[model samples]
Target: MSKRYGGKFSPEEGRPPQTPSERGSFRGARRTRAGGRVNLLFFAPLPLAARAFGSGPTELALNLTALGALLLAAWLTREGILAQEAYEARKIARRPAIPRKMFASLLTGLGLGVAGLATSGVSAAPLIYAVLGTALHGFAFGLDPLKDKGMEGVDSFQSDRVARVVDQAEGYLKAMTDAIKRAGDRQAEARLERLQSTVRDMLRTVEDDPRDLTAARKYLGVYLMGARDATIKFADLHARAPNPQARDKYLALLADLEQNFTAKTRALMADSTTDLDIEIEVLRDRLEREGVHLETRDLA
Candidate 1:
């Protein structure tokens, strides 16, 4: 066992060469707009809870109701911000149907109004609080996206298909990320994020051109599910007992998956370019046949 102390024991042996992507991409996750304000919203309703305990029965009921509404509003507001972030990130996405932020604003108003009602006792003050709170909430956080993004000139049905698959792929990635956290390894979490980013690129490619869905379906669906399951298993195993062998193997698996997904994404882009070329050629031929006489400059 004391023999060379090299090869597999050495850092350079099993480690792959630092790829440009790997070297450049081990950074942190993107910053989200859903952090500070949403977090504060969670704490903001605590005073209502405190007030609920010391008051009479009617006041206590009203305070409790207000607390529930305010907490729900906070939750909705956070979700809305995240949904908006996701919508903005993708090239093609349908509008969120529920408009969570707007609803959150209403709930904030209702909660404040109820809290005021408990103290103000049937006066104009409660209505004023409701209106002011609603306005402030709406002003602080804007409304949800009202229209479908990146849908112009694109076939509705095709875009829908792409959106559906991308959504499923995102769910799988989220699950993998959650499972990895149970292992409590920063390196593993970072590695998982890189893989998730790679998967998202392919997801974006499919979203950009729905035609690629046919080719990349299995990668996004079955392969993604398999990766998620593997991550879950590895995380569970690693959480039970720290194993260098298992960690290295899991990281290696991540590297392999990243490479394959990146290659597949590039291939999809290439196919899209070829399809564009074919379409251009067909158009040129049709124009020439119609005696349009597209010149060299026109072709360019």
Candidate 2:
């Protein structure tokens, strides 16, 4: 207290004035803080998102891998559907008929591909393709006029023996079993037993008549036709019943039988030795031109 003249406070009683360097440092600190805040707003999201997933590049790669797997699954499923349609067409025509069902399957596959592009998950594409394929297969099998002519239903006696020709050409017993199981019939067991008996008889007959390949072939055809018919009937029954396990068993059996018959037929036919004599072959060729096949070239 030295007496203050006009009420001006003394330096000791008031706050001290800032120095020039101190003022500059204070302003610099404020600017630095503002810049730091802007950087945080801009860059914080990137690190935060990265951390939420896992780590930076590793997390991104995992997401990409998952997306790729989904796409591949979808594509394969679509292709599988198309293949089933082709199979159905061949079965129905009792030969390689690749028109209506094939076209439909292709269209369905394309649609499934488009769906996969729009959707997520592996199941979406595969489930869509499988469902469509199965539906089409069932429809084709149901409508197939040649279903009865399958190796499981061929007659032993006939001049041309259409059944025998088919047995030697395009026999498929396993396919019939699959058809029967899919159809879901209660009588499948009974029909299967009958078919087995027929097959045993044919095998015995063929063994007894070893030199008669023609007769053996005929009996084989009858056996095959019986098996095919059983399968068709089984399918009909399964369609009514809806048994997944039974259907799977049928499908497996069908595949096995198809392989067996295919191998047998190839072995039998690979010789290229026709029973028809050259003269008979020439006559047969002429008859084919008229859309006919001779029962016996000389007899016809």
Best lDDT among the predictions, by candidate number:
1
Question: lDDT scores for all predictions?
Answer: 0.88, 0.44
| TM value for model 2 | 0.24
Model 1 lDDT tens row, 91-173: 88889989999999999999999999998989999899999989999999999999877656678888888888888998998
Minimal lDDT window, size 10, model 2: 25-34
Per-residue lDDT of 1-300 in model 2, one digit per residue for the tens?
Answer: 696554346555556675322232123222222233223323322333343266455445544443443344334333434434433423212332333334434444443443333333355774676457446534532222223222333333531243334334334544654564564454554344334433433343333333335734643666566557756765676667766776667656644554454445444444323533555678778888999856763544
Q: Residue 271 error for model 1, in Å?
A: 0.8
- List runs of model 1 lying over 4 Å from the truth: 1-20, 23-30, 295-297
- If scored against the real structure, what TM-score would every candidate get? 0.86, 0.24
